[model samples]
Target: MNTQLQVKNNTNELHHILTRLENESTRKEDLIIPARNLMFHEDGFIYDRSSNKIDGYVLNEWATGQFAQKTNIPSKYFRQCPPELKAVNANHWIKELSSDEDWMLRTMRSRDGSPGVVRGIMSDKYVPFDDIEILNILDDVLAKFNKDYEIEMWNRGDTGCHLRVTFPDLTTSVGKLTNGAPDIHRVGFHMMNSEVGKSSIRITPMVYRMICTNGLMGWDTNGDVFQQRHIYLNHDEISNRVTGAIGKALKLGDNMINDLLKAKETEIENPYDVIDQIAKDNKYSQKLTGIIHESFDRERGNTAFHVVQALTLASQTLNADSRTEMERKASQVLNKLVVGL
Candidate 1:
């Protein structure tokens, strides 16, 4: 006999036996229960808890016949009556076999769905500039600043140069200063999450908006736009507008405005710092920052919503390059957050 064929035949035999059990279950009203239970003891059979014909002997027999034909197995094994068949109940066999099969299937499915890397795109648009010109300008800027960086330009798509600068690992100390001002453009370096501790930084879609608006208005800096606005030169007004816009975009509470502002102010150096400070400042009051921190601590995981919110706040506050970096980082983190969940 062919080995493979023999294995196939053995499988068919098991299937046929199961089918016979099903058929026998349908032959007698009282015996239907025991027959159904016997059928459940075999592999590849699911108990239909919703079915009301558990006492239908003829139906059970028909089902068993179908199952035996499908599996290509003989029914004699199932029909055999053991010496202690009445003592060894069918329900006992069913409970054990069904549990094992259920567990095996669950394990197989779980192994198949493990998390993996996620990818996303980050895009930003800026004023039309000659690729060579932007490249030269970027080279000069990096050189003048005594930094190591590279620039690449694309002329056809967004009508602007695409510059990518590689920076050294960013520390909490560096990120702390980022909150105070837009340092990336001048510094040629920015912070991102690292496996060591902090989060990674990458370009985000907000970079496009920032670039388009700035390019349209001919402003070198986002702060320039704020300065040009004909508003009362009061910290409260500026802070409120900045915080409110970001809060709305992020879907955070009004009280979180300060923490968001502070995070933006510090250039998103340390999110934990912002959370800690907000918690301290709002010790006697309601603050979103504290709530978020507590929630994160409780879950021991990050949420896409919070990451997106942070990206929005960063866009509102950071300079073009830094904003782009934050967006990229947020995108990267968002993927992990989604997969982890």
Candidate 2:
């Protein structure tokens, strides 16, 4: 999926991330960096004092990713080079390729205090939408649902931020579990936002599988996808859309449930052949394909639903980004594999 997942989807884990963001919101600083005068180092970059910026921030993985993309360098390959070489190449490209454009580097205070991680990097026009604000608005709207809903999960980090909420009372049964109990899916909405261009602010329908804790997002199937770009967002408009999103998503949840039921019945005679095809079509590495193959074996169900189950089950163990990607792939495959789809 284009939307990268985040670590540990729980209220407490994300609350910690939120606390950090809150602290940064008050102490955060933004600087306009001119590529020509930015000096690259092994772990961070320095902005020349002439630009009226006297400090530079330590580069975290997120910051490195931003720098790599702006300079058109693969982060893995760039990091593999010797420090001296990395600095030279980074500076060269930063000057040659991005000199004409200015980048806003957002930073938070470090433990020892001088300046810390690069929280965000973007152009001057990137709008600053505080994660705390988004969550507060979302919480208010969710309370109006009045259905004993639970904030299912949350993700807040430099990479991106996300929120998922589900109503336990709002669930539907699909196939049978191994113990013969019905497989239940609960409906809710998945929300994501990234002020630094990690992702657009979006609200979409979500289906959560109770059996394996798998999530399927972006399946409104019958309503508007409320996605607002950071460049232009009205808080009131977003609140209205988010309120409407949950109701619309719940109403259409049955449509997705029916589709999933059909997919469960649609058998895949040659699962290996299908798996191979997906790997090739998506250009997934042999290593990743092998893992999926193993997961499929573990699932041992000869239907398209099993294929999706394997992917999501595997995702629970993967890193944040990889897990999101696997979930997205599973959703896509399920859509394509459904009968009469």
Candidate 3:
């Protein structure tokens, strides 16, 4: 058979099987994650009858916990589900596990939805860039920065990859310093591989603050980040897209540094008053307010620049919903103060 004909046949077959699985009353309890690895059983009821229907089924809590610990899925969803058992309620729990980067889904069924003796397979391995490709990309970009920047690999695991290229001890003076200011800041660009809803790669820009040492992405309102996704595995086209993005990313980094330098020029005579006003205006939590105060003291003084840094630090600690809110609020506050508000 032709490749196209075979592909169409496979699609129709999968749909037919899934329809049966969805309709079968007993299949709900019998359906496992390919192996007996995970089973959805009736809660607190013993399986004493062959024809017993599953009114409601939950994942085996203890078994799922053990599986999570072994597979390391528990930590990945730490913010969403600190307790691994709660992950059962998450959307498509079995599907997510089956589609995990490190594992594949297996099944034992025929094209007509019969209980075949042999098991089949469904694999999910959709990495845009492998280790060799990533290394080559970094090599090309690092040469653009010369030997002035330091390279750090934060993560290069199964899920995603991150690289931070920083220019050490390179900073612009913020505000007029009469008593000799400190040079403790550095500027950098963060390159990462992130997928939006497991769909496509979304290109983004990050700003690194020395005080908190947080590399926050999508904080700037410059619209410098470009979002792109590869529809096909065409190496040349993919490389070209990334190469073009690299040039734009460097320009965006420069623009971000320039903006920070401009903010530094607008000095605040009473730093405490401005900080207090920001806290009250934004209704910052008590914990966040305390952290901001600690950051102010740790940085050893206050300027418009320090205020930006402190708030950015606070945003890092916030929950996802609040973090986005804080990023917006910080921008508004900084814009007002930058023009001597």
Q: Output the number of the TM-score-best candidate.
A: 2
**Candidate 1 segments exceeding 4 Å error:** 1-129, 150-158, 169-341
Better of 1 and 3 by lDDT: 3
**1 versus 3: better TM-score goes to:** 3
TM for candidate 3 is 0.50
Question: What lDDT tens digits, residue by residue, belong to model 1 across residues 162-184?
Answer: 22222232101212221364222
Estimate the TM-score of every prediction: 0.21, 0.82, 0.50
lDDT of 2 by residue, 245-268 (tens): 667777655566777898788999
lDDT of 3 by residue, 211-267 (tens): 345443433455435444423456666566666765666556555566667766667
Question: What is the lDDT, from 0 to 100, of the residue 252 in candidate 1?
Answer: 21
**Candidate 3 lDDT trough over 10 residues, lowest sum:** 1-10
| Arranged by lDDT, best first | 2, 3, 1
- CA RMSD per model (angstroms): 26.0, 4.1, 15.2
Indicate the residue-level lDDT of 53 in model 3.
29
Q: What TM-score number comes out for model 2?
A: 0.82
Best by lDDT: 2
